[model samples]
Target: MIKALIIDDEPLARDIIKSYLKDNIDLKVLAECSNGFEGVKAINDLKPDLVFLDIQMPKINGFEMLEMIDEPPHIIFSTAFDNFALKAFEANAADYLLKPYSKERFLEALEKATQKINSNAPIATQKIIKDHQESVEILDRIVVRFGNKIHIIGLETIRYIQAQDDYVDIYTHEGKYLKQITMKYLEAHLPTDKFVRTHRSFIVNIEFIDKIEVYDKESYVLHLKEGQKISVSRSGYSRLKEVLSF
Candidate 1:
């Protein structure tokens, strides 16, 4: 039997999917989750073969939850929004089921998922996540996963960000957390008024800046309020000067 999980914030939506699946003896409903937090826990614990995922959920969105997983199951996205259709396909989702869809559409998506599963196809999602991140005009917060725990860091609390190979280290007053993301994406998404890419490897929050010291004729160093110093390149200094107007 094909084990599946339904993750949606609405109770009615879950009920509808369940109702449609009653006749599909080949598939089994493993669990139902109301929010992304429960969805993450269920997905990790149950390890379902297929997931009916909703894009917008409490705590974290579906895309953010997917990032936390090492190997995500074949996904059939079910959401009210049509704007995410391109992104869902970019992620190579099994199918995109718009809300209020008929049972026939659900079955069609299920058939596609079954074929992929039987063929042992892998889900490639990195590009889609990157695409989704870039589509956002501004970032108010970031989600990071450590073991089984998930942390949501607001932009206001972020002291700085440092690139570490393919991952980036996000530093806040509370602590530092490593996330698998690109600095370029963050540089483009983060609020320009509050954050500045002070160097190729560093992006600093202006509120955290204590002082700026001239390291040389072409470069400088930033002293944050927490006493951590960051190196600034000539181009970075120019950008900083434009933002700080100094």
Candidate 2:
């Protein structure tokens, strides 16, 4: 039997989904959760193959809750808001079932999800999460999973960003936290006026910069307020000078 979990805040909505699933004998309803918190725990413990998830809930919303999951199950989003449809698809959701949908619509989504599961197709939820994050806004903060704990780092607190293969080391006053993001993404997303790419491998926060000293006629190095010196590429120096207006 294909195990399924229903996560929604409304009791009526939960009942509706349960009723719809009654006819689909191939998929068994394993659990019903009221909110994202319970949903997370239930998903972990039960290991459901598919989840009927609602977006808005108490404590954490659907996207935030999905971030907490190490390996997310196939998701069929059931939300009232149409605005979330694009983001849901971007997250590689099996289907988006807007609230008040008919049983026929529900069955269509279930069939799609069932096909994907049967094919053993890998869901690219992580990439979808990253793309969804960048689509929202110029981020004031970033959420990162460091070991078992999650860290929310304010963009202003970042001293510099250094590339490390596929990942980047985020340096701050507390220490450095490794984030699995590209320099290209950060360069485009970070506030350009504040954070400047000082080299091919490094981006420095302009507020923390003490001074720029010439290494040669064309090359230079930046001395940060924290007493760390960062190499500046020839082109980087030009970009810095344009921003600093000197």
Candidate 3:
């Protein structure tokens, strides 16, 4: 039997999915989650083979929850919003089921998911996530997972970002969180007026800058409000100058 999980905010939506799956004897409903936080915990503990995921939810969205998982199961996106249909396909989702869909449509998506799971197909979720991040005009917040804990960091709270090999360390007033993301992606997506790429390895929030001083003949350093010093490259200094108008 294929284990499945239904994750949606609306009680009625979850009920509808359960009713539709009653006749599918081969698929078993493992758990039902009302929000992304519960969905993440359920997915981690249950390890479902297929997930009927909803896009918009409390705490985090479907995509953000997917980001928390290292190896996400075959997902059939079910949402009322049509704006994410293309992105869902790009993420190599099994299928995108728009809400208020018929039983026939749900069955079709289930068939696709079952086939992929049975075939043991690889999910290119990371690439799709990266592409999605780049496509975002501006990022208002960042979601990061540390161990079993999930943190939602707002742009205003971010002090700086530091590159760490394949990951980037996001420093906020609360603490530092590591995320599997690129500095290039963050540089492009973060608000330019508020954030400045200060060095090859550092992106600093302008609000957190306490002062700037010369580090050497060719480079400079920034002192943050939290008493942390960040190195600034030549080109980085130029960018800072333009942004700070100094």
TM-score of each: 0.94, 0.77, 0.95
Evaluate model 1: give its TM-score: 0.94
The whole-model lDDT of each prediction reads 0.87, 0.83, 0.87
Write the residue-wise lDDT of candidate 3 on 178-203 in tens digits. 99988988998899999999999999
Query: What clash pairs does model 3 have?
Result: none
Q: Which ranges in model 3 have alpha carbons more than 4 Å from their true place?
A: 82-85, 88-94
**Number of backbone collisions per candidate, in order?**
0, 0, 0
Model 1 misplacement above 4 A = 85-94
TM-score of candidate 2 relative to the true fold: 0.77
Query: Worst 10-residue stretch by lDDT in candidate 3?
Result: 85-94
Candidate 1: the clashing residue pairs are none
Q: Tens digit of lDDT per residue, candidate 2, span 1-246?
A: 789999999999999999988878799998999987788788888999998988888766676667768799888887887454466474555478888999999999999889888899887555655656667556567656566555668888999999999989999998898887789888888988999998989999999999999999878999999999999999999899999999
Residue 237's lDDT in candidate 1: 93
Q: Which portions of model 2 miss their true places by more than 4 Å?
A: 5-25, 28-47, 54-71, 79-94
Among the numbered candidates, top TM-score falls to 3
RMSD of each: 1.7, 3.6, 1.5
